[model samples]
Each structure stands twice: as structure tokens, then as C-alpha cells.
Target: MSAPIQMVLFDAGGTLLGTNTDHPRWYEQFFVEACAEQGVEVTPHQVDEALVEAAREINLTHRSSSDEQVRFFWEHMYTWCFRRLLPNRDAHQLACHYIDRFEVGEYVQLFDDALEALELVRCAGLRSGIVSNFGSYLHVFLDKTGITEFFEFVIVSANEGCEKPHPEIFDLAVARAGVPAGQILFVGDNLREDYQAAERHGMFSVLVDRYDLHADKPALRRVKRLSDIAQYLPQ
Candidate 1:
């Protein structure tokens, strides 16, 4: 028989919190306006296309897990996009402007289900923690969203020098959790990085598919909201 879960581990961004301005074209519109202010005119479609191309190029060459590396990665990617859109302009300046717009406290908010899920874990006498593939600013987001106290520890990729989908990072989290991997329950939104990664390490995992994005992956355990995670835990 499977071990009873003793702790609940969560992924930060999509699982516990999300950006307040969530739209299909938020970045495309943001870049369009940033370019306009710099005496250049670019359409949202142009911005989107440029970003897609830049991201593809950067991903082939960059591996960023540290906070400084994450910053540099974005700067490089956005500068590449700006250069493609406005070849004659100071692309680095435009990239800086775009990055500054996403100031920590202003961009993210706690999910409505976040508190309820944490409370359920606490009420069930289970320990709780976080394992996120985010920069060191993960703590700042937690504090800003007023959820810092809910977790016993917060493991971030930026600080650990590794990110999810890697056994090393999961090894670190498992060690810090102080519980056998089989006795820990991990909940997150990303299927490969969060759900499958945790499962491969011998932990129970629940994919938080808030938009039903993984309906085809029915073989994997999943929930539409964090509150529904209760079904996978003790009474």
C-alpha cells in the first residue's frame, strides 16, 4: 500500500499565485506601447512574432537558474526582440523599460484557492512547503501576497543553482522536507516540470490545470483548483 502523505509541497507561480494582468496578449500590447513611447511604431502582432523568434533563439543557448542569470536571460531575449522590431533604436533601453514594468509587488496576486488549500493542509496536521522554479524573488512574491507564513520552507531554483524536471533539485527539496518522498504530496500546474518530476521522485503529485489544459493527460492525477487538492489528502 502507498504511504499516507505527511506534507504538502506546492509550486509557486501558477499553483499558489498568478500574474494579475493575465491575458493572451499582455506582453505583446506592453511591448507595442513601450516602442511607441520611444518614437517607434510596432503592432502587437509584430511584438509577438519578434518575441517568439527571440525566445526560440535564446532557449537554444541559455540555461538560467540563478537570479542574476534569469535577469540576464530576459535582458538578452527582450533586447533581441526589440532589435528585430526597431533595428535603429537602442534595443537594450527598450528591454530595460519592459522588464521594469513587471515590478514584483505589482505583477502577482495570490490565487483565491491558495489560502483555502494551505488551510486544508494545516487543518489536517500536515506540514507544508514550496518548491518552485523561480528566482530568489519567490520569497518577495510570497511576502507580498501575504502567504509566507503558510510554508515551513521555500525552495527556489535561483538559490539552489538548479530548476525543476531535474532530479537534483527534487533531491534538495526532499531533503529539506525531512519526510520520505512517498509521504509528501506535491501540487503544481506544469505537467512535466512539476507533476511528472515529483512522481518520478516517488512523491504523490496533483497537476493544477486551472484551464483544463491537460484534459488529454487523464492518466496523470490532476485538479482544476487548489481547493480540490483536499480529495488527495487526509480528512
Candidate 2:
């Protein structure tokens, strides 16, 4: 009963591009390997705790600035986490190594359904873009993964000075696409940030419930993979 969507916007990170954040070994193994080289043994719990606190602090501080000074800020966050477990170790040096690895796609993981879904958007004659809470330089990962050509633009919260749940960012995305809000479909992983937020703004929203995270929300539309998006495309 709704118009066919003219555009499809996707969230980065968990939706199309995923990393070791969900994979436990990436966390435990990474620290174990790195620390082993220095003759130290650290548990995954210790590293995870430090990272949780560091991320919390960064989230709090993120409210103050929306400028392009992301590198310096992230460096501090990385150092903060590293220092908690490696007090006598070179936290700054360790942080730099980790960040450097990220630059070259050290642990970057692309979902299986990502490419097919993106291609489906193109073949369906719908324009596409990415709306992400991620920082800048996502283009690098996009390029390395061979998906950069699929998107018309990438809106980053760091550059935009605001993130999702803030209507202005979605408003700006719709405006940039030159499409009416009602004629766009947004797909992502978060229940509140991606699904509810997009729905609130008049767009058709679908949640990617890889883990059945929102099964209790009976009224919501859910897809297990990006390839499953075909059912929701405007007919």
C-alpha cells in the first residue's frame, strides 16, 4: 500500500561491514598474541573491560566536538584501553600499532550477503548510500572490500557533527538523495537507532536480526541477511 522505494540506504559496520567486535577470538586472541611477544599473559576479560570503559569515556566526550579531529581523539581512546592492562607497557606505541593495522584492513570482515544485496539495489534501479555512526575513512574499507562503487555517498557522524536518533542527520540524508522520505527503505542492525529511528522519520525500515535480537517485537519487519531484503523492495 506504499509507493515503491526509489532509494536504499544502509548502515555500515554491523550491516554490511563487520569486524571482530562480535567474534570473541579476535579480542582474546589479539591481546594474547600481542602480549605474548612481550612475555606477558593477559586474559580476554581484562582487555574487554578496559575497552568497555574506554569506549564509554569516548562516547561521553564525543558529545563535545563534531569536528574532523578524529585521529587524535581515537588515539587517546586506544591508549586509554591499552594503559589499563599494560600500565608499565608502551600504551601509546601499542595503540599506534593497532590503529595502523586497522588502516590496512587487518581484521576487516565483510558479510556474505552484503554484495548481493547491494547489487540488488542497483539492478532494481534504486540509488544507494550509506548512513553510518562510523567516523571518516570508511571509504578506505569500502574501497578495499570492492563496494565503494555501490554507494553515492557516505555520511559519517564524526563529519556531520551528529549521529542517528538525531532526526537532522536522517533529514540531511533524504535531502541529499533527492528522494522523498516515504519512498526510501533503510536497513540496519540496531533496533532503536536503525529501525525505530528510520520509521519515526517516515521511511520504510527493516531490521537485520542476525541473532534474533528483536524477536519479541512482533510488529517489526526483520530479515536474517542482506539477501533477504528482496521481499521489502518496492514493488
Q: Tell me the TM-score of each prediction against the true structure.
A: 0.86, 0.83
Which stretches in model 1 have alpha-carbon errors above 4 Å?
24-48, 60-62, 85-89
Q: Which one wins on TM-score?
A: 1
Local distance difference test, each candidate: 0.84, 0.81
Worst 10 residues of 2 by lDDT: 60-69
lDDT of 1 by residue, 34-136 (tens): 6787788898889888988887776522244788887888898789988998899888987777676654656688888989999999999999999988778
**Candidate 1 residue 12 C-alpha distance from true site, Å:** 0.7
Mark the 10 consecutive residues where model 1 has the least summed lDDT. Answer: 56-65
Per-residue lDDT of 195 in model 1: 92
List model 2 lDDT by residue over 1-235, tens digit each.
2877998999987799877555524555566566776688888888788777887776553441253446676687678877887789899999889878876777677888899999888888889999987666677788888998899988887778878878988998999889889998999988888999999999999999887777898898999888899888755
Best by lDDT: 1
